[model samples]
Target: AIALSSIAWQSGMLIGPAMAGPLYAIRPDLPYIVSACLYALAGLAMLTVGPVPRTIMDRGKGPIAQIIDGMAYVGQNKLVLGVITLDLFAVFLAGSTALLPVFARDILKVGEQGLSLLASSPAAGAALVAFVFSFRPIRTNVGNKMLVSVLLFGLVTVIFGFSRILVVSMACLFVAGAADMFSVYVRQSLIQLNTPDDKRGRVSAVSLLTVSASNELGDAFSGMLAWLIGPVAAVVAGGGGAILITALWSRLFPQIGAARSFDPAEEEA
Candidate 1:
């Protein structure tokens, strides 16, 4: 199902821009109009979906107390905390998508079409890896593999930052995306498998919040850093920070580094 969703997403990444570029060329506002329509259609489609069944938990308290309980549980679970923390810092430091326009216009000089290609490159790489993983998932040293993947992602981002050539930049972004895909899959599996069933919703909520913070705050960080010391330096420094965070996390969360599999029983034992 994940792979299927990835395919659908990447197909849009691949096809959406190809279509949008021409529309953008004709009318810059046309793409936004089309997107709004698509969003409306999506909302309508969701209205037809069946209701989801959820497991209710008795917390014996109000919302605030329940939230506190969830936060406490996450804080106590070293592995879950570690995975979330690693992703939070790594993504926060390495996010450069927000500055792609600068690269497209100033550095790469690819213009609108090039920007579209640059934007889609990562999704394309992720889609390919997702397809491969669907058939042959990572089954050993899942934790270590995730760490290595993030390390590579940081390195690739550095390469992309320094690259002046369009092909090289696109390639770096592609490889970075592939590495990120593995890290995301591993982190999610570890968290979901290790978290208690009753606390899963809360843990998942925390995960979503972390993801949002990473992306939104990372974008702000990138823009601020770029304003302070240029886009190239900003990206390079961010990538370096990601690498540093990964090393620190490996030592701080030994359980994450030592985890061998995604199986709940193996993790528990």
Candidate 2:
């Protein structure tokens, strides 16, 4: 089910650019206008959401207390904490997406169409991976696979940073996307399956902060680094930092690195 959702997400990313590029050519504002309408439609559709199942949660506590409870829950769970922090730092350091414009206009010299292609390349890779995982999910050495995926994501970012040719850069970005999706698959599965039903919503809210950090905060960090040094240096250093973080995390959370399967018994061991 998770894999299916991931596939859908990646597919949307693939389709969005193809449509946006042509729409952008016709009129720069067309894409934005269409996006706003779609968002409105989505908001309207949210009214149909069904009721949540009942759980043994303490309803008497206020929102702040519940949020704190969620935080404490995440802190106590090494598996969850390790997964979230790993993705947060690794993606923040990579920040490769933040530099797409610089690469398109200056580095790769591919122009507008090339920018769209570059943007879509990773989504293509991610969709392919998600499709495969839907059929044959990761069963054993789940932790190691996730760790390896992050490592590959960083390695590919480094390679992409040095790439001069458009095709090579696209290929590298594709691999990086695949690596990121793999880690996302594992991380989300751990969070969903391991967390209690009642705590899922609050836990998700907390996790969203890290996701923003990896995306928005990462962009700020990337842009600043690029201004300070250069695009290539910024990208290269970010990738290196992601790699280093992965190594340190593996050592710091031995149990996470040593995990064999997603079995509850094994996790409790």
- Residue lDDT tens for model 1, 1-269: 55566667776776676567778999999999998998899899999999898777875888888788888998999988999999999999999888899999999999998988888788878888888887888888999999999999899999999999999999998898888878878887788888888888888899889989998999999999999999999999989999999999999999887899989687668
Weakest 10 consecutive residues, lDDT, candidate 1?
Answer: 1-10
Note the residue pairs that clash in candidate 1.
Answer: none
Model 2 bad stretches (over 4 Å): none
lDDT of 2 by residue, 199-259 (tens): 9878877787898878899999999999999999999999999999999999987767777
Model 1 ranges off by over 4 Å: 1-3, 6-18
TM-score of structure candidate 1: 0.95
In Å, residue 84's CA in model 1 sits off its true spot by: 0.6
Per-model TM against the reference: 0.95, 0.95
- Per lDDT, the best of the predicted structures is 2
